[model samples]
Target: MQSCSPFDQAQRGDVEAKFQIFLTLLAVLAGTALLARRVNIAPAILLLIAGITLAFIPGMPAIELPPDLILLLVLPPLIYSASVAMSWREFCANLRPIGLLAIGCVIFTACAVAVATHYLIGLSWPVGFLLGAIVAPPDVVAPLAIARRLGLPRRIVVVLEGEGLANDATALILYRFAVAAIMTGAFSLTKASGTFVAILAGEIAFGIAVGWLSLRARHWVRDPQIEITLSLLTPYIAYWIPEHHGGSGVIATVACGLYISWNGPLLISAATRLQGIFFWDLVIYLIEGMLFLLIGFELRAILERSQGIAFEDIAVATLLVAAIVVVARFAWVYPATYLPRLLSRRIRTRETAPSWQAVFVVGFTGVRGAVSLATALALPFALPDGSPFPDRDLILFVAFGVILITLVGLGLTLPALVTTLGVARDGRSELVFEHENEIAARREALAAALTSLDALTDHRELSNQVVALLRARHDIRSQQLPASLDDDAYAATANARALVRELIAAERKFIHAQLRAGKINDEARRRIERDLDLEEASLTNRESGTAPL
Candidate 1:
C-alpha cells in the first residue's frame, strides 16, 4: 500500500473542507493565470506573477509550503510525466554527455559553491553545501521552455534535456546526503557512495516493476480514462514505493516513466494512443499550469518573510551568485565535453556538440525557479537540537535572489545570446529529409516501370517477375515512411510523395550545413537522421506522379 503524504493530514477528517480549499486554490490561481494571459503574458508566468502580487493583498490566503507539498504533491506527477513523455532514443544517444553535465558538473558546481559560500560567506560547509546543491541543478522546466522558444539547436536541446533528466537524480542524491549530514551531524563519503548506488539500483528496479505492473493493469483494464489515471498514479507509485523503502524517489519516477512508455508502439494500441495522448495531454497541461502558479503563490511566503535583510544586500548577493552560476556552467561545460574528445582522439559526435558560445548560452539559460525556492522553503525550520536552522533565511533570500537574477537577468538577455552564439544561424531543427526524398523518387520510378509493364499481362512469366520486384520496392518504401503510414496508403497515395520531397529538401539544407560546420559528426549525424530520410523519401515517391501541381 502507498503511504499517504504528511500533507495528507488535511486530507483526513477534514477531507471535504481540505478538498474544497484545494479545488478553490487551483481554480483561483488557474483563473488568474488565464486572465493574465489575455494580456499577452504566458499563463504560467502570469500565474507566478499574479500569485506573488496577490500575496500582499489584505487577508489573502498564505499557504505554508509543507515539505509534502513539493516532494509528494507536485514532484511525483511532474517527474513521471516527463519520464512518460521522454523519447528513449534521444535519452540513449545523449547519455554520455548528459551524464557528464548532470553528474560531474552538478558535483562540481556543488563543491565550487560550497567552498565559495563557506569560506566567503562564513557559513558551515554543510549549510553551504546545501545551498550549492539547491542552485547547481538548473530547473528542468525553465531550460526546456527557454530552449524550445529560442529555437536552439537540437543537439543543444539534448544536452539541456539530458542534463535536466539525469541531474534530478544527482541533485536529489546530494540533497539527501546533505540533509542526512544536517540531521545526524555526521557525513560519510563511503556511506554516501554506497547509499547512492543502492538508491540508484532500487529506483530503477522499483520503477520498472511498478511500470510493468501498471502496464499489466492497463492491459487488464484498457479504459483510456482509467489508463491515464493509472498513468497519473504511476509516478506516485514509482516515488512512494522506493521512498517507503528509503530509496530515490526521482530515479524511481524516471524509471517507471521510461518502462511504461518503452513499448509505446507495441503496448499502446491505436485506440489507446488516441485516448492516452488526449488524457495525458490534458493532465500535463493542468499540472504545468498549476505548478507555475504555485510557484508565485509560494513566493508570497518568501516575500513576507524578507524583513531582516535589506533589498540591496539580497540584490547584491543574488547578482553575485547568478554571475557565479553562469561562469561555473561555462567553466564546467566546454572542458567536460571537449577534453574527453581530445583524450580519446575520438572526436565527440552529435547533431550539434556544445560550442563555446553555446555553452555560454546554456549557462545563462539556468533560470533557478521552482526547485531552488521549494528546497529553501522546505528546509526544516529547526535542526535536531531544536536550534533555528543555520543560515535558513539567508538561504531562502539567496534562493529567491538566484531566481530573480537568472529569470530577469538571463531571461532578458536570452534573445541576444541566441544571435551572439550563432547557435541557430542555420535554423532551429536539424532534421534531414533529402535522403528520404531520393528513396521515394527511386521507389516511384520502379513502380512506374512496373505499372508500365502491368498492362502486358499476356507475358505471365515477365509479369510475375515484375510483380516480385515491385513487392521488394514496396517493402523498401514502407521502411522509408513514417510509422503512422501503411505501405498501401503511402504508395497509392498521391500527395504524400510531393509533401515528403519538399520537407526533405528543407531538412537536407539544415542537416548538411550542420554537418559541414562540425555541428554534427558524419556517422552520428547520419545515424541520428537515418529514419527521417527513409520516412520522408518513401512518402515523397508515393505522391510523385500525382496530377501536376
Candidate 2:
C-alpha cells in the first residue's frame, strides 16, 4: 500500500471528469441564460436556483472555494470592472447619497445585524458582529442586473453601482477588525478607526500611482494584444499591492480602474477598446455564472457543518437574521435618502427630494452576495487556543440564508416594485440623446475634412480619381445625416448601412475560404484580414452611431 498525497492525487485527478463538469456547467449556464431572457427575469437569480438544484444531484463532488482566492482573484476584477464602467460624472453628482449608502448605511446595517444576532440568538458579541460584517454590504450585481433589464432611472442605477463598488471595502475592513477581536479576545475602537482612515488614504494613493504607471506602460507598448493583456492584469495588481500593505484593495482596484477608464481614450487604441469590452463582457459572464453555481454547491457543506446545532434553531436564527438584514436597510435608506436634503439648505437647493417609493425600492434591493459568502467561509476554523471558532458553521448558514432571501425574494419582486412605483424608464431617451450628439459631431467633422481637402489639393498635385473618391464618400456620409432625427430617416440610413455590412461579410467569407484552401500565404492572409477588420469596425461604428475613429 503506497501512500499518495492529496495534492498528487488532485494533480493526477480524473481529467475526463473535470472536462465533463466544465462542459456541462457551460451548457447549464447557457440554458439558464436563455430561460432568463425568455421569461424577462434576472439571469443571476435563475443561475442561483439552477446551481442549488445541481448541488442536490447524487454523487456530486464537494466544491469548496478558498476564502483568499475569492478576495484576491475574484473580488478585484469584478469590482474593478464595475468601477471602470461607472460614469465618474454621475458618481460625483450622486456622491452624497452614494456616500451615505456605502459608508453610513453599511455600518448601520452591521450594527443592527450585530445586535439582532447577539440578543435574539444568544451568540457571543464578537461572533455576532462577525456575522453582521459578513452580510453588511449588498452585492452590486443582482440589483444592477434588474436595473439594466428594467431600464431603471439613471440616478437609481448610479447610486446602486456606487454603493456596490465602495461598500465591500468598508464592510471588509470592519470584518477584519471583528475577526481579530474574536480571535485575540482584544478590542479597540480608536485604533480600528485610525487604521480604517489610514487604509483608505493609503489605498487611494497606491491605486492612483499604479494606474498612472500602468497607463504609461500601456502607451509605450502600442501592440493591441499586449495592451489588452495589461488591461486584464491591471485589476489584480492594483488589488494585491494594497492588500499586501494593509490597505483596502477594493478601493485601490477601483481607483486604478476609474483612472484608466477616465483616460482610456488617450491611452488605448480604438481597436483595443472594442476588443477589451468584448473580452471583459465574456469574462464577467463566466465568472458570475460560476459564482452562483458555487454558492449553490456550498449548501451541502454548510448544512453538514452544523451537525451539533438543532435544525429548528438554525431555521429560526436564519429567519431572524435575514429579517434584520432587510429591515436595517430600510431603516438606514429613508433617512439617508431624505435627511440631508431637509437639513442642508445647500442640498435642498441642489438635489430634488427622492420619492418615498424610490427610496423603498433602493432599500429593498440590498441583496447579500458572494462577498458575504466568501467572508463567512473565510472565517478561521479554530482559535489560537485550539478551540473551534465560535458559531462558524452557524455564521455560514446565516450568511447563505441572507443571500438566498434577498437575491430570490427581493430580486424576483423588483420588477413589480418598479412598475408600482411608476419609476420612469429613460434608457431609450438616453440612447436618442447620444445618437443626436454623434450625428452633430459627424456633421462638423465632415465639413472640416472637406475644407482641409480643398486647401491641400490647391497646394499639391492630385489625381481627379483620388479626389473624387474621397469627396464622394464624405458627401454620401453627410447626406446620410438626416435633417431631423425621425424614425423613417434613421431606418433609411440603417438599411443603406446594412447593405455595406453584408458586402463586407461576403468579402471576409471569400478571403477566409481562400486561406483555408491554402491559396493564400499567411502574410497575404494577414494583410487582407487587417483590411477586412478595419472595414468591419468602421461599418459597426457607423451602424451604432459611434465615431469611426
Candidate 3:
C-alpha cells in the first residue's frame, strides 16, 4: 500500500480532535452532576452554567455546532422518549386545554411577540414574526424534568407535557411560512392555511403507518437484541419518513412514540422492556447534557459573531422580548385555561377546574430551550439573491438571550415559585393511589389465574405433580397480597415476599456452589439454574405486585 496522504493524515487528526472533545464533554457532565448533587441544585441548570464557564476558559476547544444536528440527532429521540412515557389517558382527558395551548396559545404568543418586536425593536413584520416563531414553544426537556422532580400535580404536568409535544410542529410551520414570505417577498394566507392542514393530516397518517409497521416488525423478530436495536431506530424512521415527504418530523415522531408507548406492554418482552427503558433513560441523559451544554457554547459563539450591536442594545432587546414572552404566556394561559369551561357546559361537567395556583405554576414554567436556539441558528445567512438575511445576528443574539433568561432565570427560580404558590402535590397521596390500583389489579389477575388453573387441572392426561406444582405457585402468589391491603397490609405483604426472595437467593447460591464443586454436571446445573432464575424473577415481580412475564 502507498503511504498515507497529507489529506488523510489531516482527516485523522480532525477525527481524533472531535473524539477528544466528546470525551471531555462527557467528563465535564459527570463532574457537573456530582457537583450539582453536592450543591443540592438541579444538574441541568448547573450543567448549563458549567458549559458556559468552559467556553470562557483559555485555549479551550471551540465546538462548532451544526444547525441540522439538533433537529436530526437531538430532537427525535427526546420527543419520542417523552411521548412514549406520557400518559395517553391524561393526554386525551386534557385534550381541550392542550389543544388551546399548543395551537391557539402558540399563535397568540407569536402574534403578540411579533407586534412587540416590530414596534419596540423596530424590526420588519416578517423578521419579527420569525423571532416570535423561534421562541414560541417552551422546550419539553427542562421543564418536564423539573416538574417531575418537584412533584407537581400530575394533571398540570400532563398539560405541560402535552403542550411541549404538540406546539413545536405549529411553531415550525409558522417559521417556514415566515421564512418563505421573507425570501420570496410573497405569501398567501389561504394557501398557507391549506398547506398547514395538509401537512398535519399527512404527518399524522405517516406516523401511524410507521408505528404500525414497526410494531408488527418487532413482533415478527423475537430476539431481544434485535428488538432493542429496532426500538432505537423507531423514532428516527418516524421522523425521517414524514420530513422526506414535506411534513413535520416533530409531529410524526411524537405520534409514533405515543403509539408505541401505548402498545408497548402488549408488544414487548419483559427483558426487552426493562433493557429498553434503561437504554433510553441513559440516551436521554446524555443527549440533554450535551444539548444544554451546547446552548452555552452557542451563546458565546453567537455573541462574538454579532457585529455593530452593542452589548447594552442586545441586553435591552433580550429583556424586552423575554418580558413579552412571559407576559404573553400569562395573557393566553389564563383564558386558555379557563375560557373553554366558561363557554362549554360539556367541558365544565367533564373536567374539574384547575386551581389558580396550578395555572400560575404552568405559566411561570414556560422556559424556552435548545429548540429555540436551533431555530434561530437555522435561519439562512443570505437570501436567494445573495443578500444577507435581515437582522440575522440580532435575531440570533435575541434568541440566545431569551433561552438564557428563560432557562437559567426562570428555571432556577421554578422550585421556589412552586413552593411559594403551594402547588406541589402530596407525594404520599399519589403513591397511595398507585398502590391501591396496583393491589386491585393484582387481586383480579390472581383470581383469574386460579380459576383458569382449576379448569385446566380437570384434564385426564395431566400429571398430578405438574398440576400440584402449578397450584402451589398460584397459591403462593395470591398469598403474597392480602384480601384488602392498606398501607400497613401492603408493607406486611412486602416483608413476606422479601423472605421468599431471600430463600430463593439462598437456593441459587447453593446450586452455584454445587456446580463449582463438580458434584453437579454442567447440563444438570444449567437446568436447575434456569428454574431458579425464573423463580427469582417471578418472586421479584410478585414482591412489587407486578404481573409475571
Candidate 4:
C-alpha cells in the first residue's frame, strides 16, 4: 500500500497539505526559538525529540521526506547560512584540526563500526563497512548550534562547524565506495582513491560554476521575493547538476554554499545580502529542524527492519562501536591539535591547544543522526548478481544502533559534560553579550539628555520633561554600572571600548569617503548595518558619547 503523508498529499496538488505541514512545522520552530534563550539545549535537537514523540502516535502514517530531496533541497541553505556567519580568519585557524577530525576521524569511525559489526553482529566485512560508512559522520548541528548560541569561544565553534562541513564529503566518499563494492562485487583501494579524487574535483568544479552563475542571474533581477526564491532553488541545482554526471552531490552543495557567501562582499549588493541573509537563515532553520526530526522519525523504520536481529548482539556491538568512536576522537584530536603547534618552530602558541575538556566534549558528542541514518537506509535496496541487496536489513539495524547509541547516549550526556567542563562557567558570556545591550540603553539615555539640552533653545516647556526622563535613566545606569563591574576592570574595559569606538569612527570616516567618491550609497541596509557597526563598536569600545565639534 502507498504510504499516506503530507508530502504525498501535497504532490497530488492538495493546497491544504502543501501549506499545512510547513506552517505547523514553522510555528513549532517559532515557539521553540522564542524559548531557546531560557532553555540550554538546541531547538533542532528539541524538535527532533518532539517529532519522534509525534511519530509514535497511533494512526499517524510515516512521512517519508526523501533523502535526496533533503540533500538537494535543504542542505545548501543551512550550509550557506553557516558560511556567511563564519569569520574567514577563525575558520582558517582551525582548518588543520577540522580536516583531521572530519576526514581522518570519519575514516577511523567507519572502520571501527565495520569491524564491530563484522565480528560482533556477524555481518560480512563489506556489509559491515557499509554500515560504518553510514554512521561515520558526526552530526554537529545539535551541539555546535547550542555552543554558538551560548557564546562559547569562537575557536571552538569554528572547529565544530568546520568539522561538520567537511565530514559530509569524507563520509560520503566512504559510503560511495563501500556501496559500490557491495553492488558490483568488486572492491579495490586504487579504484576507491581514484573515485574519491574524481568526486572531490567534480563537486568543486560544479559548485564554482553554479555559484557564480547564480550570482550572475541575481544581477539581472531586482525583486527581493523572486531573488529569494531563486536563492532557495540554488542548492538543488548545485547538487543535482553534479549528481546527474555522477559527482558527489553533498560536496557540490557545500561548495556552492561556500562559494556564494565567500564571494558575497564582491558579488552581492547590500539589499541582496540582507534579503539573502534573512531568507536563507529561515530556510536553513526549517530544513535543519526537519532533517533532525526525520532522523528520529526513521527510528521506527529502523527498528522494524532490524526486528529479526538479536537485541543482545546488537546492543553489545553498538557499545563497542560507540567506545571506538569516542576513544578515536581523543586519539586524533589531542595529537592533531598539538602537532601543529609543536611543529611551529618560531611562533609561540597557546599551551592548551584543545583543553582535555574540549576534546572530551567533542568525543562524547559523537551522535550519528541524519546523514548516517539516511545513507544507511538508502543503501542499495538490491544486491549483486541481480539478487536482493545482501543483508540490507541487518545493515540498517546496525546503522540505527550506532545512531541510537550515539544520540540518546551523547545527547543526554553532553549537558553534564558542559557543566563539568566549565566552558559556560558561571554564565558570564551571556552577561557579556547582555552588557552591550545595556550600553545601548545608556546611549539612548545620553541621546535623550543631549536632545533635552537642545530643546531648551527652542522651548523650555518640553525641555524640562525630556530632562526629567533622561535624568531618571542616568540615575539607573549610574547605580547599575558599578555593581556590574570592578573599578580596574571597568576602567580597562572602558579604555578598550574607547579604542573600538575610535576604530569604528575611523572606519565610518572611510565608508563616508567611499560614498562621496560614488563607490557606494547610504542605502536602507547601510542604515541597518550602521546601527550594527556602532553596536559592535560599543560592545568593545569604552568611549563616552559626545557631540562632534
- Against the true structure, what is each candidate's TM-score? 0.73, 0.89, 0.89, 0.72
Instruction: Give the per-residue lDDT of model 3 (tens digit) for 1-549.
Output: 799899999999999988987898999998987897786567778888888888888888776678789878788888888889888778888888888888887888889889998998788999989899989888877787778777777787899999999898899889889999999999899999999999888887788778888888888897788998998899899887777766669888888888887777898888788667778889999999988888887766886778678888788888989999999999988988788889999888978888898889889977898888888889999999999999999999998888888888888898898888788755345645666777688879988997888787775567889888888987777776665546577677667767877888898889889988989988998888777777776666654433221
Off by over 4 Å in 2: 1-13, 426-435, 441-468, 482-549
On a 0 to 1 TM-score scale, where does candidate 4 land against the true structure?
Answer: 0.72
Give me candidate 2's TM-score against the actual structure: 0.89
Model 2 per-residue lDDT tens digits across residues 201-295: 88888888888988898889888889989988989999998888777699898888878778777878877887888799899888888888778
**CA lDDT of each prediction against the hidden true structure:** 0.71, 0.85, 0.83, 0.69
Q: Which candidate wins on lDDT?
A: 2
C-alpha lDDT of residue 82 in model 2: 90
Candidate 4, residues 77-147, lDDT tens digits: the string is 66656655665566666667777888888898788777866776677888778777777788867777656
Residue runs of model 3 more than 4 Å from their true location after superposition? 1-7, 38-40, 426-428, 482-549
- What stretches of model 1 exceed 4 Å from their correct place? 1-44, 309-313, 347-354, 427-429, 432-549
Residue 49 displacement (Å), model 3: 1.1
> Model 4 lDDT vs. the true structure?
0.69
